[model samples]
Target: MKVVSRIINVVLVIVVLCSLVAAIGSAITKEPMLLTVIRSNSMHPVWERGDMVIIENLKEEKTIHKEDIIFFKTEEGSLSKQGWIAHRVMSGSREEGFITKGDANKYTDQSSDGTVPIKQEWVAGKAITIGETPIVIPKIGYLSLWAEKFQSNPLLIPVIALVLAGLIAFGEIKFTKKRKKKSQGMELQLIYIVGGLTIAVIMGGTMLTSGQNLGLAYQVSDKSQGVIMGSDVGILKVGDKVSRPLSELSNNGAFPLIGTINTSDKQIELSHERVILSKGEQIKSTYTVKAEIPGKYESSIRVGLFYPFLPASLIYFLSEQSYWLALVSVSLVPGLPLMVYPFVNGKMRRKTAKLLRRKKRKIQSSLPF
Candidate 1:
């Protein structure tokens, strides 16, 4: 019984440490780690609300076979408030993208106005599986979902921090009174404090630096005259093609990013399909829209941004072959360091402590006593 209890305690500690590492890594790297919560019954029998899904980052291995379940960012104005959706690929190709539908849903997502076919650039990751079955922890994500609400409240964080600090101080005082000896308790406390700060920073930063939804609104008029107005708002007659400069895309972040521009309609042609931008650089390209059957039509250009961890040329080439491949390759950069650092750091610390103790013993033995 004691051994079983000890094993459970060890497991819990490891889980807590891993969660802290993921939180801090995500904040520093501006990328998501491998876990996500299922918020609805869309997945139904396979995965329901309050279940935790383990995601395999597609940035390294970008192959998406038919029937593979993928996690992707939803298009602008989607019904989901979380801005992401996970669904199974029903059918499609890499060049044209894939059609996706939830297991419990009656129709494909593209049947609605808000979601289009699942594009490669929009895909973040896929569900990790074992021979056709996805791995999920049932009902464990309820706590996470409950805590998620507090993320939006700015004042709550500081209050929570103060309460935690007070509690830690009280515990330390009591422990000191009970036993007056130096131990590793201080180090563990420091780790806990740092972990809390990491969670706070990640939650706050993501809320502030969230992605912007930029789109174009055009009116396809029936008038015989073709009078092209503004870039965002334009009026075009049937069978006429007009070119207009699109909104400038700027990279203010520290890393270099590759942006792929995609349009809703087939008639829209961009001057540049893919663009690379370094820090503090910006680019503006023109898009030519060829009006077909005239009516009040709305068209949107979705730009997918990717951090170019690999060589820009390689990323470009991979994107041409498969956008999913390019995305998967670059995403490995942030997560690799986070996963490897804990073990490496622990090993180094152990070695250093052993050396210090050996040196101390040598000094004591050589002393004239």
Candidate 2:
């Protein structure tokens, strides 16, 4: 039982460490081509929905060739609206951009017109395929796809975290009891350790939930005059501000627009009101969004939660320094006393034993010596 518990604990620790590493690595890379799960069957028979695929960004446009499978930024107003697409390179050259087509599709993405080709700048990455076979890990992406459906509901995260904490604490209690039946005093100490760890986990999970619910960051691509992306659950309360780098445009035609601010649960204000952004080369602005209601709401262009959903949340939680620091603080507050009590109690016991021995010696010496 002890060995098994130790192993389980070790595995959990390793998972947490790996999550932190992955999150940091992804941030440093600046590209989203780390690991993404397929949500569509556009590249069917080869890679299906719920299949996990690793993406590596193509460094140079010259390396791209016909027949290679590549992932690129999706055009606006597409059915999926996922911002990215993966397809086979049907035809093109470096100078004349590329026209990609899904293997299962009848025509190209542009549907045979071929007038508007995917620019070299738009290509994100090329799928690493072995010969004609695309290497894929099957059925693992279901978690991601399922999470996307509930991605709007941020509250689910804390609820899940609380449940996990309770379950873990219960398991630890049982395991400690079964392992240390003789050491009754150590039971409470073990609980302290277990409870502290559990609380830390819950805190980390809650941090992730809050970030997903409240905070967002996005970059305006050079190709796009304007773009909006976000979840419906994301609410910007009245007086809340969204700050981002604004692109400078010669004309007022391409100014930033925030649309569809919900007034009530049913009614919405279609806001096409243009706000003047700071001028010069690097135009940056923080638009203090107006909300009809004083509570949580969603914007038209909400941020998206990334792939491998739950794991992403965990990783994201660990990525921040504040969460880790808070975890340490919270864990140590209860854990320190529990850990020190055992040693402190041992010293007290030894002192008491020593005093008893001295008392015995004094009594003997006084009696008949």
Clash pairs (backbone) in predicted model 1: 58-328, 59-328, 59-329, 60-328
Each candidate structure's TM-score, on Cα atoms with residue i matched to residue i, is: 0.49, 0.48
Best candidate, TM-score = 1
lDDT of 2 by residue, 1-369 (tens): 979999998866654443333333333343445566676898887799777676677776448889988878745335235556788998898888787888888878866432367778777787777886776767666654554432244345445545654665586667755765444443455554555554444333322322221233223222322233653223443433333322222212122211111112222322311222222222222223433345333332211122122233342343233333433443243234434553467754564466669778989999864
Top lDDT prediction, candidate number: 1
Residue 204 in model 2: shift from native, Å?
6.5
Query: What is residue 73's positional error in candidate 2, in angstroms?
Result: 0.9
The local distance difference test score of each candidate is: 0.63, 0.49
